[model samples]
Target: MNAENDLIKLYSGRILSLAGDIPLTERLAEPQATVKKRSPLCGSTVTVDLVLEGGKIAAFGQDVKACALGQASAAILGAQVIGRTAEEITAARDQLKAMLTEDGPVPEAPFEGYEVLLPARGYKNRHASIMLALEATAEAMAQATG
Candidate 1:
């Protein structure tokens, strides 16, 4: 198979669906903290706005401008970000990086949904876009708590 075929496999049906399923595409009215992450290579961007209560995320919003891979990552994060803490988001981000760069297993539980991205492992340029959402969320959580 050629590289184009490999890229096609990476954007499987499930991944495309997730990419289109981004849930929180609006900005928060009064977010406690907000962060925007960008991938210089792909020019993909994901902006996260959040409110934290009692050390956990209470409300969240996002504006995602990325390719299918990045959008899928944001979709997963949006689906599960509520009630999450900075620690959890950071852990997920680390796990994702390991998965893409180190032949690591899919991220543990809550993040196992990332298995859909397994095919993306061989494509290094796409990694930055795929990581934008989680990175921004973790940073926003820190700013909210800082």
Candidate 2:
């Protein structure tokens, strides 16, 4: 497909709509861990805060500063991140990375919503921005658990 086609698909209505409906848009009063990831390529960033209890996330919040693609990803993460384990978040992050760069299948449920971003597979430059939320999430999870 041409670049225009790629851009059109990448910015579909569903993604643009999802981008505006982000959840967990706050900072926890006292988080167990917090991580911020930046896409130097796009100057997009996502800061994730987590509070874990009983080996699962009990509370979550995020400060998302990114493009539509990144916001869409944060929306997905915000939807399912609570009550999930660090390992689960890490797996989803890995699956998303593979889906973008290695021709892997969509991530499993909860995070399955990431399918909206499949068209981004062809745009290498946008990959980092698209991944900001999950990267920050996974990193925050790791710090929270360890």
Q: Pick the candidate with the highest TM-score.
A: 1
Q: 1-146, model 1: which lDDT tens digit per residue?
A: 69889888999999999998899888999999999899999899999999999999999999999999999999988888898888889999999999999998888878889999999999999999999999999999989999
TM-score, one value per model: 0.97, 0.96
Candidate 2 Cα lDDT to native: 0.92
Candidate 1 regions off by >4 Å?
A: none
Candidate 2: Cα lDDT at 64: 94
Clashing pairs in 1: none
lDDT (0 to 1) per candidate: 0.93, 0.92
Best by lDDT: 1
Instruction: Summarize candidate 2's per-residue lDDT along 113-141 as a digit string, tens digits.
Output: 99999999988999999889888988887
User: Model 1 — which ten-residue stretch has the worst lDDT?
Assistant: 104-113
